[model samples]
Target: MALPVGIFALFVLMVLPIPPLLLDIFFVLNIAISVAVLMVALNARQPLDFSSFPSVLLFATLLRLALNVASTRIVLVNGHEGGNAAGEIIESFGQFLVGGNFAVGLFVFCILLIINMIVITKGAGRVSEVSARFVLDALPGKQMAIDADIAAGLITADEARTRRREVTIEADFYGSMDGASKFVKGDAIAALLILGVNIIAGFALGMISHGLSAGEAGELYITLAVGDALVAQVPALLLSIAAAAIVTRVADARDLSGQIGGQFADPRGWLPVALILAAIGMVPAMPQLIFFPAAAIAGALWWTLRQRAARPAPVEQPVEEVSPDRIDIADVSDQTLVTVELGYGLVHLVDKDKGAPLLTRITGIRKQLSRDLGFVLPQFRIRDSLDVGANEYRVLLGGLAIAHGTAKPSRLLAIDTGEVRPGHGLTGEATRDPSFDCPALWIDPAARDHAVSEGFLTVDPSTVIATHANQELLRNSDQLLGPEEVRALVDDLKERAPALIEAIHPDPLGLAALTRIFRALIADGIALAHPQPLLTSLALALQKTQDFDSVIDAVRADMGARLIARICEPGERLKVVTLDAALEGAILGGMVDPGTGQPLIEPDCGSMIAERVNRHIDEAKGPVALIVQPPARRALAALLRQRASRCLVLSINELPARQPVEVVGVIGADNPAHQLPAPTEEVQAA
Candidate 1:
């Protein structure tokens, strides 16, 4: 509203006659405003700090032009009376400042106009144009760098958004200045035209209307004309200089004077300049007085700067003392459920614009594992780490580094798929696979086709990190489940099977107990994808006993088919790698009690069984189940849990009736496969 009203007043200024007092006030206001603008331009540290400068320039230009029109009106109508007909401001410039000579006032006005139009305004426009063009050109690259920093975890999402906004403002400021510079150029041109019109028209009105002699009319009218032009042109010149200062100023953290002073404060840079000036002073044709004084001043400045540099900088005093109570434990919580920390070189693996597959692969892993495990997989927090090698990445579980490996961002990883042609022999740069620790090689992307032909599995750096992260999530699925996840399961169950959930032991089998049971199941490699039987088994098991081990045993018994499905494919005979009858008997004998369900195996016996089972696992072609008796199954699974990650201990009752069994290998026995039963009808059908 104020801007429109001001513009309306500017138009009214041409028609209305201003008293000399008011005209003088407006003239002073114009000069003061121009000085204020110049001061602001000099103090601005960056272009964005004065983003409103371009619009201010446009308004100031219009105000000066409007004032010129009003003063022209007054001069033409009343010039024959005296110099004061226009205003005291114009009269002072005409008579006193110009020594009552119209010619001197004209000369000063033209000189100001030439400086503004030809030098300052023109140069400022070109600078604004180039700055705007360059800023626009660099905008996309700046945006990409911000996004990369966000992905690399060097900055948070909020910081990235702020930087993007700054980039936009910088581009907009320069673009506005590019167009606004035209206002200064036009103002300079208009000042020249206004001066000419004021002189010619004022002379005509003085002679025809007031009937003055030619010499008298010329003297009186020309004096006021030059005065009005000078008053308006002075403000115009100040504004042009202000515009030039704004456009030419480079961005720094300090104001113009501070920047210049700091840059030249060093004696090293100015010593050579001082020497040059001193040498020039000694030349024959050079003015000795001017050049010698300048050299001495330069030398003095250099000496003073050197003294300042030799002095030690004062230490800064702390404003506030740090207290022990101010230490926040939350700052070091360190309870990250899952995270992937990338080294700087692997930072590109998380960049979405680069089509990095790590984040997408992690999402897919969460989705697939959630369905397979019957519990939501926790989100993995991806970040960057400077502590590791540039090509390395680490997978963390529960804030502990669980696995780490290196990848080549510009190369492909080709795993020895175990089916390579003879003599091919893993030909590329050998490395261990991050996901499974399988022997693999990093090969150039150009060699990917050849690697694939040689039966190697080729993957990129992103896929390598992602696969490793996914495997870790699955392997540590039990540790990842929390009370919050358990509550989510209960809430979901209540929606579909309210009464079934309600029937469970509310006193002994709450969310915590259920979460423990699920953790135990997942720890033993049980998939909870079908929750109905597990819930039903838990409801029944809790009715019999509140003991956790017994209840977990019953749940495992009830999930027998689901567990078997994990080890055996559809319609395939289940391969058995069992223990010798004697070893099984010893394990059963080692049990402290069947009811208490304690395993008291001797150390030597326990070590021997673990070694045998691990050996069998190493020899197996694919997944194989270890069939044990019902009483010893829980204790034996617990015993092998630490040593053999792949081995599954199953009780005979847990086996599906229709599935046929083949004894492929046995722990603690020789020729175990030779002891296999001849094909029964069920085995033949399978």
Candidate 2:
């Protein structure tokens, strides 16, 4: 309401004749407002801190122009009387301030106009135009950076919102400054025109009406005109300087004075100036008194600066050591089911304040894996490590590093999805995709479009780290499903089917044995997406046998069809590599220590079987299983676990009867030369 009323009153000032006392008060108010604006501009740490400066500058310019009209009215109307026509503020400028010389006042007014119009206003306008253009051009890149930080989990939603608001305000301030500069330029021109009118019109009217001569009228009226212009121009000059200061302000945490003093604090900077001044002082033609004293002052400043520079820095206090009794055992523990350790540089990837998306992404990964695996994944702990290199992160499982890699937040990784040839396209730091080790290039963000067009998949550093963590979580799924998770699963299942759990547990299969079976199934790359079939098979298997291995085998056979379908391409015939008749007979005959539950096979025969199966697996494009008789499945699986962990051993009874089977390779028969001598012959001789 105050601003609106003030603006309206400024408009009224142009129409109604202002009293001399009110005019002086208004003149002082204008000076005070301009000074306040200049002070605010100087103290503003960032341009956005004073976002309303352009509007204030506009209002100040209007008010000054309005005062010009009122002062002009009083000057032309009453200058025929004397120099004290307008008010004391005007009279002081006309007499005491300018030594009662209208010529000196006129010269001063012209100089102020030139400085404001040619120097401050013009320079500020150009800076505003350039700043607005550059800020607008960089807006998209800045927005992307913010979004990338958010995705990386560097900043929280609230912080991102605040930062985005600041960016908008900054752009708006510059754009407004660009337009508001015109007001100052126009005001300078108006001041010139008003000065002309007050002098010429006052002289003409005074000579014709008051019977005064041209010289008397000119002397009297011109003084009033110069006084009015100077008073208005003084505030105008301050406001112009304020505008220039704001437009040129760089974004920083320190105010203009602090920034300037900080930058100029170096002793080395003053030493050169001192030397130049001393050299000039020694010249014969120069004023020895003035130059020598100025040189001496500069030299003294340089010497003082050197003394400050030579002073030793204060030593930091050492950190106090904590007593052993005060240490918490949990704080020193390294036992976490899953942990993500980031280096100092990559810490922004988990900082909610900066908008890093890694934490959120890890949560999503855990949720998806937990849902797919039929058990809730344990909460993964994240911490920053100074021991690791910047941009490097380690994915730890049970306090051990499972996967680690380096990523650059400011750059994008363009992975070649077999679309672009390796070492082709844009030049960059050649690297591998951390998750899959696929060939990739770390390129600048500006080259993302080019990389995409050239058939490369571009991703930021946060995505790369998240992907690596996700892969590690999947690969270590078996270890993640511990006793606690199993107990949790039982508790959840009890809510829906309490009778089913009561039927088999404690009496036949204890919780520990059941957990082992689940772990084994997961280790074999089987998703527990549907738990009913596996649970039903476990219950039925417990009725027949108490052996956990036998129960696991039974569950696998029961879930074979679904698991097989999941592994193979839709509608494609199952392709598997099988052992020869002799190898199967020998393996069955060599099985020993049945009471001990250890199906031991001859090492030579086991190695030969593994070598052949691994070769076939390596050649296959998709997943292929090893088909054997039902009795040999568990023993052979255990024997080949270390050598060929990827080889899936499926019993003939487990799969559909009369199932279409394409024998791609006969494991032992295809390489007859690789077969070992019979264990029976060596044993009989011994």
Candidate 3:
């Protein structure tokens, strides 16, 4: 309210009767002050002092001083006596200065300057020190440790499991980031205050001007300068802390990382935008009427465009006519992996800028395989593949690693819809199609020779079948059989026997497929009982029909423990996972990745371990008790606290060997066991 009226009064003074010399002197003082500040800041190696801003003030002051001086000198020399005509008019505009009015204005400006200096001097040094300290830390991960301890006969496995889950929950609600949530509170408050103050000041000035009947509004020019300079400082501090907090939290979240937050969470970007904008707004007479709001509108539009671009398509395109073939048991070969490049069936050539998904058909194939199979399937790990730009995934039921065979690859495809087309296939470095040169295998060689000699089958040297038929034929043969019958039969298989080795478990593809199926079953809460019976049946069937040992190994892993237990029934292994209640709070809260610090993985499992451990280990006392209250209301405080000398670590390998020892937490907890808070979701997961 006072600003617009004040500007008018100042304008009036510029034309009032007074000494021209004093008005010029005041202007000169302002120029000298800005320059002095700049020179000092430069000498101190401080950032340049408001380079553009002080220039604005400097130019205004100098221009006004020059005009006043030019009029004074011209009138004095060009006119009669010592009195100059033009200088007289300039003199009339300076009447306010003859009184105490100018002195008061100068005093007010000086007071404000002192306050600014006090704030800067007090804040700059501390901020620098804090900034340096944050620069030297790393992100967080201790879940592996917690898991190990559980396996090591220290803490209870169930407790460890609970803590890991807690960690995830806490991160979901509060963010795995260090200070993000806390900083938001402060930022929101400060931003609101700034917005409120500016709006009120602008409106109040408008009303005062309306009352004055000058069709003029309050002078917000100076108010804007002061408000911006003052209000901007709030975010400068708030956001700096926020950035630091995010860096800390995320650093703690990641592991196998060089440092936490590496580059992703750095505050270098956000803080500057706000401060820079505030500064531009503070320029005196900069005519903010056009650019300021326009920049805001432009930024919003750009962000909206980018977001629209990033969102993925709602669903995969519908599968239409391609080929008509029902791939059967013989199609998938043993000890072989095949990947077909599903042609960019939808669009032969990708339109880089215009198309959605923006990836080649091969990428789409991988996505499908990943979706149908599992993200971390063993089959993917072991098998080799190449996309032929054909819209299909085919299986090789019979193929050798280094031998050539005559067989066709087949896949089930919809023949009715003809949108997607198939192209020739490529393998390794060579292109292959219906007549490709690739190695393959069939029935067990031992059984094959016996059958041929016994005159049990017709001769077709080029054909090979799955091994199970050969095994049964040999077993029923009157020709002699031995204790190592299966092994001898396998050794006799000549088609690709030289390249075959017993696989203990499913390869990456097999693993992924199984996992995907398992996940799907779980999604609908399907039953999951002991794997032994199911594995045994699959193993026996495959062994009898295909002579494949993939299922055999699967069953072996499932029942190996039981068989081992029966053999050594007196001594059984210990628990699976565990944790210590005492070391709840001592684990580090926030650190960045050692490599590319991003917040620990999406739901940093380790950070939760750190949180839980820290909480368990209180400040004053040596140990505390952990408690889990019923009806867990929130993820934040789910576990109860307990006190002890050290958390009891246990051994998962030998159940009888459970041991006690502290893992992570403060050395001595000050609070009572009951006072300890529950573990955060992230902590439980860790």
Candidate 4:
């Protein structure tokens, strides 16, 4: 309301006639506003801190233009009345400031105009244009950086949002300033034109209407015209300077003065200044007295700054003191689910000065695994360990060593994947590839091209470690997931399908139960990458049963087609290994767990089944599924989990009806043989 009323008042001044007293008050107010804006611009720590500067500049320019119109009207109508006819402020400028000399006043006004328009306004406009363009061009990169930080867990979602908002505001501020600078440039030009109008119109009206001679009209009208122009030009110059200062500012923690003062406080910069001034003072042609005093002041400043630089920074007080007897939980236990411990010799792989190649590889692995797996993997920790050999690194899961290998930091590993030429001349140490147990040679980096020519795949030491870690992590992904990950998954799903989440969570199932279900699914090779469909399947499964195993079995049956799709493409025959009917029945009835009421196979029988499954897989030379009865599925899956991990075990009901099948081998048969089942309707549907 106040702003609207003030704007209305400005327009009123331009239209309605005002007394000299009121006009004088407006003149003082315009000058005060310009100074206030300049001070605010200088005091701002960053351009965004004074985000309203563009609007302030606009309003101030408008007020000055209005004042010009009111003053011009008064000057032309009353030039014959004398200098005081306009106002005391104008009168003071015309008589005292310029000593009643219109020519001198005109010359002074032109000097100020040239300084404002050509020097300050032009330069500020150019700066604003370039700054706006650069900021807009880098906007996407800034946004991407914030998102990357969020993905790396370096910042939370709220922090990322705040940073994104700040980036948008900064871009907007600079863009506004880019256009606002034109206001200053135009205001300068307008002031010049208005001054011309006053002089030409005042001279003509005085001679024609008031019947005065040319000299009298010139003396009376030109002086008041020059005075009015100077009064308006003073504020215009202040504003142009203000505009320049705002656009030229760089973001800092301190204001402009403090930032400049802090940088100039260095004693090293001052010593050279003092020496240069002293050398100039010794020259005969220079002003000796003035130059000597300037040299002495510079030398004194250098000494004072040197003393300040020599002072030591104060030490901060410790927040808390630890007792010698006290033991902390963090010291005794590792909180991270996954940790990579490097030996002293391998420490250089993770050094930042060396580009942290190992860390970079690990981050890439984490991102890839997060996409393949369902949930975000927790951050992995890297630390130095003395327990391992100098060239060895160990990966730990839940504080237990899961994988350990050695890497030679000074050489590359040339892997022989049955492709290397026989008797190729490559000299290095012989070793086995830790990732796949392939034959490999640790060759010099200089021989990488030769190794490639000999059909050897060359990889650096960091890739070897990172690849090994990735394999181990993928195999143990079930262990990486917890209740927190499940909660996050649920929260994310709730955003898209709240009703679907509401059907299963906190009603028929709790968070712990859902976490266990998800872990079981992941262990069975069902990724949570597409949770909407998986959760929807789970929600439908909950409609029939609430028992943990029953719900899991139901969901697995619902998602049977997706599971089959992961291993075999559409319209392709799936290579399968089935159990002998008699053997499967025997195992299904042999033993039952009292707690789970689930059929369990005897240890010897389980080992025999696992061995046969592994043999069938080797013969097939590709991924094969072991199809069994629903009652015997869990028992066989557990038996072959570690021994024949490559063979996927599925129940009869879990196999999709439309999937084509080829019976590659029959496990537990008298003579193992490959048999293609007839293309009958029943076999095709199974």
Candidate 5:
């Protein structure tokens, strides 16, 4: 739409008596580019990830605006404005404001654009809006604001309105460059019309009184100017403002949270546009001044008023050098002894964009960070801080660790401290690392424990964590222990519970089971980290216990009878025709077994399992390491989706069903924790 108007403006300028300028060409280019952009945006199928758009637009706008300034400055400062220095810049810009044939054509086009925009606005308003997702740590982070509303359970529902909208008001930096306040669409149109009417009317009056006195000619120009101001500028001003107001109101409604102070602002722009448009429409001949100040001033005033209304009340600042009531750092977050151990090497922190991912143990808990990120350790109360260059910043979490690396041209994002959940053994790991340069954050001691349950981080012992109970010792365990010792250990476990420990045949059984279970919960998009350890421990205890028969029954009980029944079912099938029909969305009457018609596994208990299972299913995430082929896989998947206490359905295939849960810790079957592989095939044959 903007392009069509621009093209018509270009076509009109080509034939117009007045000379065209570079500014007019720039406007043409902008309209052309905007049209192309709109087409592309409409076709993108995926959710628009607008994370980088704002910054990119800001850079582009700034650069182009600078270009505009330089162009205008060079032209005006050198006294090269076709007219003169005082009004040449204005005249140059005024050419782009186009009236007469250009104005009429643009006016028709803008009307169409407005109508189409209204349709889009109304239709889009009816569609459901998707909420933005944020990145969080897998393990819980220390709380920042103990929001008052959270304490009152207000955040759970609608108490806290969604504040996810982002708004950017593109200010025309060319205002200062043009030696005028600003220019908007209305201003450009108004200016064009002003030029058109003045030129046409002035020519007509001059011809009409060919033999008249100079005073008569001057009177004609004055009459044209006054008549335009009263009959046209006044009404046109009101109309332009009304249009802007309507557009702004609709915009505000559509983006309640995004109406920033400067959004939909800059009436100076509209004023210019309005003046140009009005000037073009009146009496064909223009006046001498041609509404020189009218449009720009009016638009500027309107913009100022809009922005002024939204400015926030100023915050009262403390004037005294020493704040008498200022509290100590310890007042908000008492220092803790325990610290989280982030295990990434110094290299990781240096190349943090890639390294940050590699260094953190982000489960789908607080943040659903990928597994490869490793254990992102946190500083104690006095660890790292933004105190990078501060005169002094007393350590908050343990001490700081600033691993040295060559600086980049610019450091976009840097996290100096881990969110420390206060009580969970922070002080124990609060050792110092002066090598690191980042902020150290601390939490209230009591706060950490209350925030996290044990199961959240209770990962399998096989998977190598950044900082586990033992680091160096575990690394050398393989080298120190002979093959015979390892064999003996395996032999002993097999002998003790031959049935349960039938074999430790290398497989992703443990890892797949664990990952699968959690993955399902994670997809549920709900919180469910609490039962991981409980389930893992149960799997281990069952594997180790001597009383296999009794424990299997207990396992069934712990798993809930329905899950057992499902797993014990005969075949694989995709039961849920849709996600809504899955156990997550199951209700009593809708899905009762046909024969018994009994609420498929009693309604009350089903609800409880659904809640618990949903939570776990949402958390377990990873690869399909252990493939369970055929009926077995199908049965397991069915059980997990429909009846499990807390489980996810990884592909149920040839993978062994009785594998211990510890496998989850292992990345794959060829784990460092597992026994060495068998000898070559030739050697086995011999």
Candidate 6:
């Protein structure tokens, strides 16, 4: 209601004749509004903080233009009466501001017009145009960065949505600014034209209507004309400056004044300024009095700033006394199961002042892992260590370093996952991705869009570290489970199915046996996220035998379909890489490990088998299973666990009867025999 009423009033001011007293009030109000807007623009930390500035500027321009129309009417109609015939504000500008000289007032008004139209308004308009273009061009890349963060588990869905909204608001604000700048430019031109009309009309009206002499008409009418122009131009200049300030801001955490002051606070900058001023002061033709005093002020500022810079930071005294003989366990050991230690240079990724992006990403990873593994993982501890390289970080499981990688804290990693176009011409520090060993480059953060356009997946330093940690956690998930985790799993299951829990715990299988079986299942790529069916299978398997091996075998055989589902989708034949019949026979009757009495393949044979399986796995580019007899399953699984980790090892009994399988290749066969024909539809036992 207020906005509509104010807009109606602006139209009324332009259409109806305004009294001199009311005109004066409107002039002062316009000037006040312009000043208040300038102050707000200067204090804004970012352009989006003043999102309403464009609309405000439009209304303010209309008000000023309306005031100009009303003031022009009064000046032309009341010129012959006196200088005060129009308004006190205009009279002061004509006499006091320019000293009663119409020529000087005209000169001042023209200079103000030039500054507003050519210097400030022009530059601000150009900046607004460029800013809008760049913002719109980078919109896609910015959205991609948010999506990448979400995919890397650095932020949740809600945070991503908020970031996307902010990006949209920023684009809209700059776009509006680009259009609103024209208002300021047009206002300046309109003021110049109004000045011309006021002077010509007032000059002719005074002579023609009141029969005044040429000199008297010029003196009275021209002075008021220049005064009206100057009055309007003053506020116009202020508004132009305000617009310039708003568009030129660089989105800092501090306001305009604080940002400038902080950048100019360096003592070294002041010292050079003092030297330059002092050198100029010594010249014979220069004004030594002014230059010397300016030099002294600079020198004094430098001295004061240097003293402040040199002051040592205050240190706090310890409040507690400690005995030398006492030893704390926390200082010597880490209680957390997973620990991430970063070098000094990478510590900023975890700094709370910078939003602690690494901490947030790690928390997201933990949540994701807990959901996948079906248990609450222990809290991961992050700390700084001086032993590692400045850019290196290590992931420690149970205080032992399992995986380590280097990251550039100030740059982004653009990974080429075999999709980058040839001759992309990217220049940076060449490196390999630590997580996947893919070709990558450590490029400047500014080149993220270029890299993305070139088909490279660019990720920030925090995302890189979090991804490495996520991969390592999944690989070593079996070790992460313990008695406490197993206990918690059983307790949670008890609440949902107390009868099933009673059948398994403390009777045939105790906590220790249950923990070991769950660990084995997890190691074999069977997740316990759905505990009801898995625990039920284990309870039923226990009724047949108490032998640990037999119990695991029965449970795995019952859950064979679930294990196969992890790798192969339904309605698709599973690709199987198997050993030759002779090779399997030799392995079944091979030398045994004395400790566990399990069949062990010779070293050379094991390496050859691992190499051949890896080749087939790579060629397939999907999950492949190695089918062997029950006795050889353990040995082959252990051999391929490191070399061909993607290959799922399954025994004859563990393979589902109804599941369709394709024998992709056979290891330990000649090159011609390697390309074997597809077998029958059903899976055949090895």
Best by TM-score: 4
Q: Between candidates 2 and 3, which one is better according to lDDT?
A: 2
lDDT of each: 0.81, 0.82, 0.32, 0.87, 0.32, 0.89
Tens digit of per-residue lDDT, candidate 1, span 50-164: 8899899988988888888888877887787887888899999999989989999888888888888888888989999999999999998787676555544457657978999
Error of 6 at 114 (Å): 52
lDDT of 2 by residue, 315-420 (tens): 8898898887797878888555787888898887776556547766776787788888988776677788886888899988988889899999789999987888
Model 3: per-residue Cα lDDT over 115-151, one tens digit each? 3333432343344344334432211233544443342
TM-score of each: 0.57, 0.54, 0.18, 0.74, 0.22, 0.54
* Candidate 1 worst ten-residue window by lDDT: 671-680
Tell me which residue pairs clash in candidate 1. Answer: none
lDDT of 5 by residue, 185-238 (tens): 333354345535543554454546454344543333323322222222222233
Tens digits of per-residue lDDT for model 4 on 598-672?
A: 887878887888887788787877778889887777877887877887888898899877677888887677755
Residue 195, candidate 1: how far off, in angstroms? 1.7
State the lDDT of candidate 6 residue by residue for 1-686, as single tens digits.
Answer: 99999999999999999999999999999999999999999999988888999999999999999999999999989889999999999999999999999999988888888888999998999999999999999898787666546543457668989999999999999999999999988998898899889878877888899999889999998998888988889988888899999999998999999999999999999999999999999999999999999999999999999999999988889778888888899888767789889999999987755667897788789889989998878777788899899999999999888899999999999999999999999989999998888999999988989999999999999999999999988988999899999999989888999999999997877889889999988888788899999988988898899888888889889999988898899867888988888899998898999987789899999989988888888888887999998988888999998888889999989987767788888887764333434344542443
For model 4, name the residue pairs that clash. none
What is the total number of backbone clashes in candidate 1?
0
After superposing all C-alphas onto the true structure, candidate 6 shows an RMSD in angstroms of 11.8
Error of 6 at 653 (Å): 1.2
- Candidate 2 vs 5: which has more TM-score: 2
RMSD of each: 11.2, 13.9, 31.6, 6.2, 24.4, 11.8
Runs of candidate 6 exceeding 4 Å displacement:
1-321, 671-686
Supply candidate 3's per-residue lDDT for 205. Answer: 45
